[model samples]
Target: EDFVGHRNGAEEFVIITTLSFGPPLHDALTRRLTEELHSFYNFMERDQGYVLIEDGSGKQSQKPLMSAHITVSQGEPDPNAQPSKAASTSDDPWVDASEDQDQKPDSSKPSGSAFDW
Candidate 1:
């Protein structure tokens, strides 16, 4: 996996590579992963808040398992930006509708069909 950090136009990359197998490859891979995470964490800590821009996975040459990329940018989000109309007007019942009082359970469908036997 590769995690790239961008701050004020500067870019830093951290790559983690691991071989397949259970206990035989565990320690080294874990150590490397931990080191890379700490390095990225320190970089982000120095740069402050960052927003994730992209994430994807694909085949890589060095390792048998597929590789992944995660990109983060230090650019600040627009504070004055308005929500999209489609998003604001969304009628989907599940999203942010926990407090809604108008919804009622349907009585027409049997409640326990799986237990009917």
Candidate 2:
């Protein structure tokens, strides 16, 4: 056997094989090489032994997996700027994109509250 699957930049879909079989044909050749490498990479058979593929274009190809589970996020930032003294303090109040739009919200201090984590 030789199977090899991909998709992994969070899209997740790893598979890698190299079978031979012996112990009573190793559980039917590892379940027929994980169902022929999930139908040669088309994937889509989730339940207990998960499997779901959809790399329409999001990008993902770095390989390396005996098993994996990923979930990452850290996107939004730049609502005008200035929130990174490690991420807060230092007179927070940003949003002055060169000021002068009927200026307000700086009533002397007290502004760090946008769902401040």
Please give the clash total of every predicted structure, in order.
0, 0
**Highest TM-score against the true fold, candidate:** 1
Deviation in Å, model 1, residue 73 alpha carbon: 1.3
TM-score between candidate 1 and the true structure: 0.21
Q: List per-prediction Cα lDDT, in the order shown.
A: 0.38, 0.38
- Name the lDDT of candidate 1: 0.38
Give candidate 2's total backbone clashes: 0
71 Cα displacement, candidate 1 (Å): 0.9
Off by more than 4 A, model 2: 1-22, 25-27, 43-61, 64-117
